[model samples]
Structure formats: structure tokens, C-alpha cells
Target: MYVAVKGGERAIDNAHAWLAEERRGDLAVPELTTAQIREQMTLAVNRVMAEGSLYDPDLAALAIKQARGDLIEAIFLIRAYRTTLPRFGSSLPVDTGAMACDRRISATFKDLPGGQVLGPTFDYTHRLLDFMLAADGDVPAAPEMPVDPAPVPHVMSFLNSEGLIAQETCDGTPAPDLTRAPLELPAARALRLQALTRGDEGFVLGMAYSTQRGYARNHAFVGELRIGTVPVEMEIPELGISIEIGEITLTECETVNQFTGSKTEPAQFTRGYGLVFGQTERKAISMALVDRALRWEELGEDDQGAPAQDAEFVLYHCDNIQATGFLEHIKLPHYVDFQSELELVRKLRRDATGQGAE
Candidate 1:
């Protein structure tokens, strides 16, 4: 006999206890530290930070540990934690031109000012599995080169100088905060970039792939892709001075896309841009593609009705936290709804049988 439970408090408590025990699998095995995840599983930590819109590595690592290595859950934890933090002051935008670049490459030009520094990329690596890595691998140290302190000019600037590319204008207009406000349609570039940077990696990748497969195909050429550290500065209100607070690693991608000339303007190349926290080149490049696709309206391109071009559709569905919550909620108790549906089906069958006999 099935006994109906009245209150769910005890059941919920017991379930949480069981989950905690399951999260810590074996008693004999050594526990994984947050530092280990931060250092060893760096990519996972980067994903959590990017999606959570928080730059704290320690907190992101702790979230990963608490969530049992589930990246989406980790992001949720970080996001929830970030909301509790008090706002102090906004930092001035860090200039990427002054970045201490570790890796810089340009697909459009053969020779650049930085001379194509390919620092620590998996581009040329073979996809073979290393047996040593499976069993506490001892890796040799990589050769080091002194980081150049010179400012590397952007590749797009070269094109802009030649008057072959369209120039972007910024009149110091403040960007809208997607986190603070409800998403309105016809989003600006800043808001779109914000959504893309924190959007689900897999979802953004799929949308970019769709654009590449002739679904709003924009001939995207990698103008420049860079990964490096840049200084963050904040203005002191009391002292009237701007001081460097810290430095953070960032990845920036600029994609040059094909352009069509209007009656008022000449034919010039346009650009798609992506900037994200940490060394996330794949996400950066994919973001650039999706960004370009979304800009079809502004650029006077015809609406192809592609998934990537649909801003509302992409932004709404790209959030893993919301999607996971709605999906997982389906597993909750639905006994009453199921019983009602069962009764309706039984009555419908009986009525059909009676009509057939008549």
C-alpha cells in the first residue's frame, strides 16, 4: 500500500542528506581541493566565471566543488553569490591595445606588428591520447620568452587607415545592463555582447555553426585573436584619481565580415567582435560569428530568419541556468495532474465503446 506523505520538509531534508553523501563518493579516496580544481581544471573554472559573470576564481572553484563538478550548477552558484555582493564603483574600461599579450594572431594579414605570436595554442597539437597523463603525468617545463612590453596596434586599424573597412563610433553612451533590467527587443551591441559572453558555450557554438552552414553565412575572417592580461583601473571619488586595482586575463576576437554598400556609403568591410574573461578562444570566435549574424538588421542585410540572427530566440534560450531549472522541475511531483489525465482517458474510452455498441 502506498501511503501519501503530508509535509515535504522531512522528505526534502532526507533527499538533500542523501545527495550530499553521494557527492562525496568514496571515504577512502582523498578529497579534491578547490585549489586543485582552480589550477588543474582551469578551463572548467573559466567557463564558470564567464557564464556566472563573475571574475573571482576562488569562489568559482568553490562553486565547482560544491556542485560536484557540474559546470551549469557551478555557474548558478557563482551567479547567486554575485547577487549578494554590494556595488562599490564601476571600473574604467581597460584598453586592449595596451595589453601584455601572451598570444596574438591575425588570419587576414601575414605580417603584423606583433609578428604573429602563437603562445600556448592547441592548434598544431596531435589528438593522440597520452598514457602518461592518465597516471600522474610528470610534464616538462615549456621554453619561456620574455613578454614584450610594447603596445601592439589592432589589425583593424590598419584596414581603417586604408579606408577599406567601416569605422565604429562611440560617443560615450553608457551601455544597458542586462542583469539589472529586463531584456528589451532590438538590443544594442553592448547588451548583445554581454549576453553572448555569459551565454551557454554549447548553445553559442551551435548558433555559430548554423551561420557557417549557409544559414546567414557571413564570410568571417579572423582579423585578430588575442589572449593576455590588462590592467583594471577604478576612479577614486574622494581623491579624484584613477588607480590600477588589478590585472585580469582576457580573450578578444575581431572578425572581418563582408559588406554591402548603400547609396550613401561606399563598399567597406564590417566587423564582428567578442571579448570574454579568461583564455577562451573558441567561445570568443564563435561569439564573433553570432554577433555578426545578429547585426544583419543594422548593417542593412536582409533578414534570413536564421537561429543566430534571431536575437530574442538566442538570448532567451542561451541561459543554461533558466533552461536547466525549467527542465529539472519536470521531475518534481505531478501526481494530481497525472491522475486527472488518467481519469479523462478512461472516461473517453468508455464513451467510445458505448457509442460503438449503439
Candidate 2:
């Protein structure tokens, strides 16, 4: 057996020190504070929390600063830290119907019950460079008005009222935890969504966009995109009731996709759903599209061999953490395997020469 290179320990330590120096850039510049990162680089923090499957903005901000704004590295930091945290208990699913929305809009409906609240979106902004931001320019503050607490009901409810979509069924089966369990083939809705929520943003976005471009195009319309905090609760088995545990900010995107109904059932609109931590409507929307495409099998539609329609394909490639780790691990020593291939080639050459001589 070929021996491997030594000094991985010392090399790792030295690399870490170099990384720290690289992250700092210069000793002359003042260090960025955690609070500053959290406040100023909020979008980065939102991404880390969304991808890391954690809800702590503060921790995500710290991780981003430490990683020097390398989002993958920030995600790694958050994932590592999240693994260290204890799972005290599982909270009951948040009642998303009662979301106190900061931003609520529907592409399908021009007007809805709670009128759209376009809170803090860059949708209208030009893609050109904003040179003024380099010097911290400020815009005039708009009038601040408090939103009503009565809750904004969904636009899809109107369709549901007419029995156009499948009515939501509540079966008491406990959902599988992706983090704790290894992902298996043919994932259920809970498993697929869990993977999608923490999945790579860019990858999911591309897959989502592909649907629009006709890769398993289900003719999706954004049914709703809502961002808000929902109360988390836990069932007290002893007390026979659920108590409020805490709250988590979430972005939920529900898409209404066209479905040509099966022989057994009448034609009805199907749903594509995406829910992720933080105010990430883009990721949520992307996720919803992919989710709908993957449901071809369950909905009894033809797969058409599309990437988005393949459950195994989408679930496996969605997360960059896993993808990157596996892809990069190859950088480590593989001399033994290389030597084996070298020997095989050399032996083949020798045999060919010997046969020519004979």
C-alpha cells in the first residue's frame, strides 16, 4: 500500500491562521463588529440562516464576518455551529394562515383581502451600480404605519372555497427530520421540502427558472408570497396541550400550477410549495416551482424525463454544502489509487511490447 503525505495537522493549523489573516485583510482597517455585520450585511445573514436551516440572524451575521463574506464558508460555519446546538424539543408547525405579514403579494390575483404590502424589496431597483452606497447615502424615510394584527388570509382560499384545488388533509404522521436521518430515494413532501429549504440558493433558483423555460413547465403562477414571523409551539404531552415556544421569521411561497387531472379525478389546480427561514421570497418561490415539478409522479402526470421532474435528481443536487464537500474532498491525497492506475498502464505497455517481440 502506498503511504500518504504527512503533516495534515500542522498544515491545517497553518492554513487556518492564513485564512484568518486573509479574512481580516489589513490590520490598519478597523475590525467589523458582529452588530455591524448583522445590521449592514443583513442580506448575507438572511442567506446563511436560510441555507443553514437556522433562524438566528445574529449568529449568521457573525459567521459571515468570520468567513469574510464567502457565503459557502458562512454556511459551513453556521452548519457546524448548528450541529453543536441541542434539540430541546420540536415545536408544533407554525400556523402560516395566520401570518402577520411584512410582505404579501400574489401574481395570480390583482387584488386580495389584505392588499399587498411591498415591504423592503429591491424588485423595482435598477441593476446598475449604486455608487452612492459606497459612501452610505440615505433616502428620505417614508411614513411609518403599523399593520393590522387581524392576519392576512391567503388568495388561494378563494379557489379552495370553490373546490378547485385539493383540500389540505391533516394526517397525524410525524414528519421526518432530514438533518438527523440520511436522505433516501423517493422522498415524501416533508423530506423533499426540508432538503429544498436548506438547499443551495443558486441551484434551486436555476431549477426554478428552468421550469419557467419549459423544463417540466407546469404553467405556475405565484399564488402567494408571504414573509413574517410565526409563533412556534410545542405539545406538552403531560398537559395535553401545545404551548408557545418561540417565533421564527419565515418566507413561504405557494404556487398554483396547472394540472390536467387523472382519469379517476376531475381536473383541478395543483399546488407547489416552498417554505424557508428568513425573508427570502426568491428562494421560497424557486423552491415552490421545483416542488411542483417533482410532484409529477404523485399527481399521476407523465415525467417527460425532465431534471426538475425527477425527485432523486432535485433532492440530491439541491444542497451545495453536501455537493461541495464531496466535490472538494477529492483534493485530498489519492496517491494510492493513482499508483494502482499507473501500474495497470505500465503492465499493459510491457505486455504489448513482449507480444510484439514474440
Candidate 3:
């Protein structure tokens, strides 16, 4: 119950002015450009793009700048701006197998088809902070290898051919658009994937960690993880042909879990899939774990009463925008509601003490 307070127009205006001044910071220091955020703060920009459900790096960089590095606020700005854009026709599904991979590795097999290409990763880097970067260090360029034109096959394909892993099949059913439609319960795998892809990274990571901590553990192993650029194509109505629209970098993860078998079906390894915009491997891996956890019913496994296994709970709370909106609204003025509660408590105390009404 919010009561309108109409006397703070000037205060609100001045507050906004102060916010703008603070966003600019000290005038002596060189102002950070959006390009710097896009390049230097690449991880932050990628996170914004992934959770905001928009892939425009420039807009994401600008939002980060405008929000003063508050990533959630930047995501809020992106989501709000996304609503106002006109809807173009949907593009065809990208072919991950045809991706021009920068990084590709397999935990299941070291000697896979494409071999391991550790393009750019922090896996081998020491975590010590370098003061040289603070003093504007000039880094030497990384050595480059000639681009491979051969198509990189998916690691899961090998297991599939050997009938060791569960095979995924498409029923030709169109996937639901969670943006246009409100999220409904008993969501299909496609809808859940949509929500998880744009879901809060922290929340998803926590949930996935819980699984590894023995809550609904599926004995998961990373089959393959790849980060690469894939071409996006859209069909033209007039021409009746698909044309390449653009390319976007993505991180894809495929996890193999414990085998499931029944009296009717042979035991085959289960799979968990994750795909996210940009090079967000952590989020992608987390998404895969949670995705598998939610599939307990589909996999004919007993529910372990875990938070990750509860679809309603996971889907409802995973959205950072919705969670933040509800949580932040309590900070708004609630004087009238508070006063009413105060009076009620006072009257109750007075009655308990046998005092006359005042």
C-alpha cells in the first residue's frame, strides 16, 4: 500500500542531476569510452549480453557505462530497451557443429577429433595481480595459428554413434517464446533452456553447485566445452531463401551424466546441454547442470526434493530482473501502510492492558 507524496519534485530532479554528476566522476581523469568497456571490460559486457537476452555489444557497453558498472542495472536497462525494439522475423537455429571454434576441449577424451585447442583461457594463468597493467603495460601479441577450414564435430556425436549416450530428437514442434508469453509451469525443455540461458548467473551457479554438493547429484562429467562464432541466418519472405544475417560468439557445453535404464530400454548415458551468448563458460556449465537436475522426471529418476529439481522454484526465482524489482520496491515510501500497522499494534497493546481507547 503506497501513498503518493507530491512535494518532492525538486528533490527528485536534483537527485537525478547529482546522479549524472557522479556518473561522470572526476573531470581530471580521462572519461572511459564505451569502446574501452567493450574491449577491456569484455567479461562484464558478455555477462550483460547473456543475462539481458540481447547480443549487441555496443549497447551493452553503453549500458554498463550509464549504470556506472552496476551490472544488474545495466541488464535492466538492456531488457527495458529490448521491449521497445520492433520484432523482426526469427532466424533459423544456428549450427554449433559448424562453429569456427576459438577454444575446444573435452574432459571425457583428451584425443578427440579436432584435438584440444586452448585458444584463449585463464586455466593456466596464475591469479597474482600484475601492477604492470596498472602502469599501462604493453603486452606482446599472442602467436596465431592458421584457421582450420574443417568442420568441428560435436563430441556427443561419437557417443551417440556407439549407442552409449542418449540421442536427442526433434519433434518439429515450435518452441515457446517466453518473452511474449508469461512463463507457465511444467515447462518444456526448450522453455526451460530459454529461461536458464538468460537467468541470473549467480543464482544458476549456486543451484548447480548444490547439485555437486550431493543434492540430486547426477554424477556429471563435462563431455565437451566449446566457445566459438556461429553464423545466424534468417529467411526472407519475398525471396524464399535464407541469407546470413550476422555471427555471434557462443559458449556451448555438453555434460554426460549417469546412465539410466529400465526393463524396456537399454542403459544409455544421459545428457545435459547448455548454450549461452558470448563466452560465458561458467554460466553455460551451470545451466547444463541445472537443466539436467530439472529433467528428473523425463529421465525416470526419483525426485531428490532438491531446489534445482523443483521447476516452479527454479524458474520463478532465476530471473534477476523480476527478483530485483520485487526486492527493491520495498525501499519506496510505505508511510501510510506503516502508520496503519502502527495504529493496529498500539490498539492491540492498549486492549491487552485494559486501557481506554485514546
What's model 1's TM-score? Answer: 0.94
Per-residue lDDT for 1-358 in model 1, tens only?
2234677789889989998998888989899899999998888898899999999889999999999999999999999998899888899999999988989999999999878999888899998898999897899898877777897999999999999988888778999987778677788888899999999999999999899899997789999999999999999999999999999999999999999789888999999999988889999999999999999988888998888899999988888888899899777777888888899998889888895354
Please tell me which predicted candidate would have the highest TM-score against the true structure: 3
Give the TM-scores of the predictions, in the order they appear.
0.94, 0.93, 0.97
Global lDDT of model 2: 0.87
Tens digits of per-residue lDDT for model 3, 147-245: 786779999998988999877888989999988888998899999999999999999999999998999976799999999999999999999899999
RMSD of each: 2.6, 2.1, 1.3
lDDT of 3 at 220: 92
Model 1: ten consecutive residues of lowest lDDT: 1-10
Model 2 agreement with the true structure over 1-358: per-residue lDDT tens digits: 4455687789889999998899888899899999999887777788899888788989999899888888998899999898999998887778998888888989988888979888878998888998788777896788888878778888889999998986666587887888888899878888898999999999999998888899897689999999988888899999999988788888999999897778788889989998988878889999999989988887888878888888888889988899999899888788989989999998889898895355
Q: Rank the candidates by lDDT, best first.
A: 3, 1, 2
